[model samples]
Target: MTDLIPALRHLLTLAWQCDPRRLLRAAAMVAAGCLATPLIALCLKGLTTETLAGRGGSAVLLGLAAAALLVLELMMGHFAHLAYFELGDLGEVELQNRLVALAHGRPGLEDLDTPRFADTLALVRDDLPRTRASLEAALQLGGLAIQLGLTAVLLGLLDPWLLLLPLLGAVPVLAGNRAQRLLDTAKESAAPHQRLGRHLLDVATGHATAKEARLAGAAPFLLARHHREWQAGTRLLGRAHTRAAALRAGGQLCFALGYAAAIWLVVRQAQHGVSPLGDVILVITLAAQLSLQVGTAIQLLTVLQDAGRTAHRLDALKPLTPFHANKSDATSAPLVLTRGIRLEHVSFQYPGSTRRVLDDVTLDIPAGTALAVVGENGAGKSTLVKLLCGLYRPTGGRILVDGVDLAAADPADWQHRIATLFQDFARLELRLRDNTGIGDLDRIDDDAALSAALDAAEAAPVAAAVPGGLDGLIGRSYGDGVDLSGGQWQKLGLARALLRRDPLLLVLDEPASALDAAAEQTLFERFARLVADSRARTGAVSVLVSHRFSTVRMADLILVLEHGRLVQAGGHRELLDAGGLYAELYRLQARVYA
Candidate 1:
């Protein structure tokens, strides 16, 4: 409670950053509601004292005063609750957007792939909404604290000894706080089981994984695993809840005993003629209000504690500053690429791994160039491409664009000028148009441009087969939407990349891996023409990563990579004459076709 002001200040800052106007309104409502409760308590005490003492104040007037304050408290409490809920609902959308953006702003998938980060993200996703939706907690808490203070004043007026009653009532909440820690600890302790339970449930019931489960007749095993995990997590939670309930029950007993002791003292004072009859009445009213205040305070403290926990968890996540809306200008602003991209002694090693994925490699990709990157498995071809697209920053050396250091370039703008279609492309459950249109988000609704991109990707046929052309849903799980073959999906991926008409760099990793020879050739032909048009218009550079030597032969320049090193670089004929790694791999692939 000592650090309560600073902690709450930080939390309020987070909410205010989302929407200051709404926060202000919510806070005002809370204050109005909280003040009314204490006013009502004081008014009731005044009415009780006046009615009992037969003082100068009329009984009817005192009754009316208490009634009016009671009505005000009721109205303010209800309105405050409604306003708090509305405020949270309004902030939900903006807060969710901020969280998602923050996660994506991480530069690479490494952190996302780690179990610790994944768990934290999942919890944050769930906790943030719950915390935001609890505006009632804040208002209720304020009212409870204010009511407690008012009760203390009334008790002190009865007799200075009676003032100790409210303090004694606080024992239960202190015990409850310790009990609540057990619940929090239990949740963390059972996290592994909870995760396992969720994963097993997904495997058994999810549309994609369900097929394999049923086909392999492994449903029973999955069901059994799900049952076990659910039991494990539930058992721990149940135990914590039970223990907390017992402790709270004990605290209630203690409160009842203290209430009795308070009433006894007030009655004894009255019997000895040391206290008035009105003082006894006031003590009784204060004791009852004190109990309510303690309970309300406990409820409010629990909510605040939960929200504080959520904020702490989110704060612990790495690199949250990158996603702050105010910091978007320097890094997220668009970068202009005119001349080319140059890798000067570029290198990268995955965290916790000693092996460098890309060893000191220097390369130049001139504007209007078709560069082919050929390598065997684990030669770091994809890693290099990820670096170019700003998915990951290089651990060593630098990437220069038109003589400007890539590090100094606005990351978002730099990414905007590059588009990549990897071997494992995402299958977005969206309409056919959105599937491709998302690549050029600034003009996603441009019907004409979307059509042109589809044609360029040779995905016109894929669209024609669908019912609604651009609007038809393309994922099986989405309504009665039809699924595409791997080749069709490849074309869809290609269309997504081509949607960016003026991208300075285009990276295609195994673009036609699933297509037949003829289909591959046709897609490549369209791609070549698209590249020429883009190159002429914006000095575009395209990188092709493929195992097919036939496709590799078409690139203006070929760079052969082996074991994270560039072993060969030249035109296909020059590499063939040089008889290095490129020639060796190319001849081997050609022999298979022969």
Candidate 2:
């Protein structure tokens, strides 16, 4: 009882805060419905009593009242449904938008990577809206209570002992409540298996994995695994359903037997002249109504409780809302780096893990310098990029921009001064112009700037091939869109990054993964030239993360990393001249060409 009130309060507060007017209207309609439903029984009772007494004038009046009540019930039920639906529409959109914003604006990506947080996010996405609409269930529960009370009162007045019918109705109510509890528990337990089954089904059908699946002939394997998971989930749910069915049937049988016995007693009393025929008729009607209301109340209670629990989960996940008057950093405007970035004793380990991805790493990225980071897989290259871009805060030490602390600055404003093209960059599937312009949306419609960015990334020919050029859709999923080859998509990603005019820092992590050796060389050379030109004015710095030594040799400084430790850092010529790990790695890669 203690837990239920707070859970209900959480849902009620959510409903009232979002769209109070619609929620209030829905509540009023529920009350009207509750009042009208019970009055039907009363009007029927009056009509039956009058007719059995042979009172013609009273019978006609009572019959008219019953008809009026039937019309009221119909109208009330319709309006109640309408009001709740309207409220639901408003709440669903608002709550979903808030949940999305919370997940995205939570200040770090670490929480997003965890399984528990993933489950919370999934619930927010698929189920929170239904929880938002639970206000209707809550109000309906209120209506059910009122109906039960009215029916019980009327039955007692028919014969004082007839009040026992409401108590008898409790058996069915308890059974229904228990059944709902079991179902909810089974459903919750099955969620992980259900999710796995759905994921396996997607893997079997997804276009990205189609080639691999076909090559391995693993479609049958995937299907079998999917079926296995589905059975695991359904097995428990099936058991729960079977158990609940038996409980429901048993409770219903008891109610039916008790109802029959009550009717017999009422008829016997009327025959002996202890009670009027009207009294017998009233007892029969109210007895059935009491049972119906009890069952309805139980159903509504289950929904309200489920929604309340979902609401509580959502409340736990809500981020600290950003306010208009938030404390601004000293460098509120986009900062321009004069000296460069300095990483002092930086080390990072992901949440819930002990191993550091970057271990006590230190580096000086001077303004106007081109640096290349060369490392094998799992050498912490991506983690370094994330920390540099403020997607993560270092577990130890600090990143200083010239002299100011990067972590102390506003992440959004800091990020605006930087551009990156990751290996797994996003494929927006938007129009070519919108896709390119996403890097600097303020100039999205600026045709001259768009043309320059596209030309700089050497995507001019690609754009010209499309029928509508910048306005053409770029993916086949929608419209008359054209999907680009892997290499072509990499070039588009480059164009989007290059579109960020006057960026103080640029990081390209394996930006040419899909391109050929010759194409990769040409693209990196062009990028280097572009950086040199931009560096001449804005003191911009560029960092390239690559495995290819041919591309690595062009940078002013080549930083070699191994197993999360900096093994060497120097100019390419100096590194080659020295007989170190960098020299050995360069020689090994040079053998590939030989």
Candidate 3:
């Protein structure tokens, strides 16, 4: 109960932020609805009394007045729904937008990988709108309160004993409060179960895991786990709901008995000539009307409690402030890395990991040069590329572009001047043009530039094969779409990287892993030609990571890493002559082909 107040306040704040006018209108309509309810009860009493008094014309006038009140009530109810719906829609949209922004602002994927965070995302995405509607219903509790107060006052004028009738209905409202608390506790306890279900669903449905599941025959194992989670969640929900229903039913019975007692007392008073027929009629009518109002209030309160549980999930996200760059550095023109890229004693390890991925590694690359990184698996090859692209920061050193430390450089500005094709590249389920255009969305529609990029990346064949050329859809899940082979997908990814207009550096991490030997050879030759063209156009540097020694041999400089440390750095022939780790590994790979 203590936590509920703050949560409700927060939801109200979010609602106001979405649209103040709509909220105000909804509130006004609800107030009007409350007045309409009392007006309806008054009209009912007047019509009954006038007909009993044998005043035919007066009864007719009272009937017409009651009909008018009914019409007004109906109108208010309709408009209230409209206003509430609008507010709910706006609030849901606002919450979703804020949640997306908050998720993206997380420092790294570490925060996103937590089960708690995942649960929060699932609830926010799936339950926010329902919660918003629940909140609106809860707000109508004020209208019910107004109607209850009005009914009590009118009944009191006839006889003070009738006031006790509404007090009897308060029993059920108190029981509802208890039920709400229990439901909230149950939901909070089941959060972990919900998260487990979400994890199972992700593993079952994810594209990357689909092939592995089939090959390993693991579908049944995963399905069993999913079913177990669902069963556990269902059991918890069932117990909570059953308990709440029992309490509510008991309270409702007590209220009903109290109402019957009140009516019997009114009848006894009329029999003794202490109260008139009209007065007895008024008392009975007010009691029933007020009882229904209290019932509605209780139900609305329950809904509000349920919505509050879901709102807490969305409230977990924290906001991030914009990054600050050093003011001492002057803002350069569009291009900045004119001289070279340099890493000075950089060291980094992933979160919660003891082993370092990159340890005091240092290197430099002049503008227009091709640097190749070669190493066996687990040698920090991909980690280096991530750091270079500013996706992750070094724990202990600085990366400099043109002598300016990247930490002090604006991240957005640095990203604008770089392009990367990671090994785990995104296969966006969008149009062919959008897949490539995402590399540089600003100039993606430029046909001449697009054509040039496609040609240079050896992607022209795949593009021509697409049904509608660049405009064709590219995913199997959608209509009229075609899926590409692994090698063809790699070429499309290369085309994406090549489409960048002002990239000062290009990082390719095992870019040809999917291609066959002959296709890789031809692709590398075209890649070299494109690099030369790109360098001539914008003086961009290229950093390639590969296990193939033949590919690194074509680079201006080759770097060999062992156990997170740089073991050898030189041109390929120089490293070969030195007979170090690079030379031994190169010969080992060379023998595979021989």
Candidate 4:
């Protein structure tokens, strides 16, 4: 009930922003149409009275008036639709844009990984289609309120007891609201299971997993798991819906009693000649219209409430976004890393978890230097990279880039000066050009830049092999699209990363993991040269993460992490000479290849 008014206001605001003229016209039409219902009933009563008195002229005039009111009701509603339809469409687009901004507009990426945020996002996405109807619902609810008022006044004129019908209508409205709340709770509870069910369905049906599922003979297992999740969610929602229906039925039953009593009272008055037959007709007509208005109001309330929840969910996400980390008067990042990056006792843990992913660790990375990080999986390598990229803030301590606090620097400015390639890079189903060009949106269409990036990543051959070269589509989801192999995709991702020219900090986190050993070595050599070129131009800093010792030894400094701790840090030869974790792991890998 509290959310209802705000929801209507939001719809009106959206409508006004889209087309104020249309909104005003729609409201006028809806009001006129709603008034016609009670007016038509009034004419029906007048026509009955004149017919009873055998006044042919007056009866015919009243009959024509009733017909005109009926036409007004139908025509006004139709005209309202004509005006509101475009407003609804435009409002839906505006809502979707707002949702998109809520999801990705923040500087930090914390909310993207949160389950609650994901649930809200899913719910809002499902609500998007109903945005069009929500506008109409808001208008209809206002018109219904007016219609109910007029009906109540007419009933009061008939008899004081008859006025109770409108009050009785409240029973169903309250019940409907309760039912909506119950269903809302059920839907929120079922979201996780529904999401899991959909994931399994995608896994079972997706082209990427089809071959593996066939070889593993896991189709039946996946189907059974999907069915379990789907059934779990379905059962919860089904029970809520059943209970809601029963509550509605009970309320309507209570209203039905009042409706019967009012009609009986009016009929009795006419039977005893205490009131005219025309008054009985009027009472019956108005009472039936009151019943219809109540039901329509319930349906409209349900639509409005659902949209209200979506708006509330969107509002809830605003605080979760990390905009507070950004300063209104932010300082610009350094154009070059003269003093390099320094991490002082930096530590991090995810939002709700206590277990630290990156424990208190201090390190310095000099400008124009190549630094390598090596560790087994789950050693906080990626978390460290994320912090460096300003995608996250440290739980303890701060990072300084060339003596400027990274946290205080403008996130957009810092991001613009850095480039990265992570292991699980995006496989965008776009044209080959866009797949690579998206790395630098400003230079997406720069052919010279594209060619250079392709050459640096050794992806020129891959692009040439495609039907339309860089313009060729990259996924089978679209028509006549070309699909690349795993290694080919990695090369394209590397090309995308390399497309960003003159980055102040270059990060390649296992960027060539999918390629063969020889290919990986070749790619690393090309990357080393690119790093050297950036360093020469702007004293850049580069961080490389890889398991291959052959690749790790190329770095000017190497840091070994174990269980979120910096266990060893030195040059390749110095670390080997120190004869600790680095030496042991290097020897073991050396033996495997020997």
Top-TM-score structure, candidate number: 4
lDDT of 4 by residue, 1-594 (tens): 766988898889889999999999999999999999998889889989999999989999999988998999999999999889889999989988999888886777778778888888888888888988999999999899999999999989989988889999999988988999999999999998998998898888899998888899999999999999999999999999999999989889999999999999999999999989889989999999998998898899899989888888879877543544647777788878798999999999887789999998899999998989998889998889889999888989999999988778888889888888999899998988899999999988898898889898998888898888778889888877887899999988999889987899999998878998788878988988888899999899999998888788889989998888899999999999999889999999999999
Tens digit per residue, CA lDDT, model 2, 360-417: 9999988888889887889888888888888888999999887777777777777888
**Inter-residue clash pairs, candidate 2:** none
TM-score of each: 0.83, 0.89, 0.84, 0.94
Each model's backbone clash number: 2, 0, 0, 0
Q: For model 1, how does the per-residue alpha-carbon lDDT over 1-594 read when each residue is reduced to its tens digit?
A: 432454365456655776677767766766665566555555665666676677645767767776887777677667766666766665566657767875775656666755666667776677777755445565466556666777677678767877777877778887677777787778777777888889898998897689999999999999898999989989999999999989888987898898999999989988999876766766776677777778876776677766666666666665743522453445442233467878999998876578889999998888788988999999988888888877777889998877767666676777788878999998887898889999988768998999988887888999999889899989877588878988898888988998875788889998888898888999889878877887888788888999888887889988888888888888989988999788788789888888
Per-candidate Cα lDDT values, in order, are 0.77, 0.79, 0.78, 0.89
| Consecutive 10-residue window with the lowest summed lDDT within model 3 | 319-328
User: Candidate 1: how large is its RMSD?
Assistant: 4.4
Question: What's the lDDT for candidate 3?
Answer: 0.78
- In angstroms, the error of model 2 at 24 is 3.4
Candidate 1 Cα errors over 4 Å, as ranges: 1-3, 10-69, 106-115, 176-197, 218-256, 271-278, 318-339, 431-433, 461-489, 513-518, 547-550, 559-594
What order do candidates take by lDDT, descending?
4, 2, 3, 1
- The TM-score between candidate 4 and the true structure equals 0.94
lDDT of 3 at 255: 90
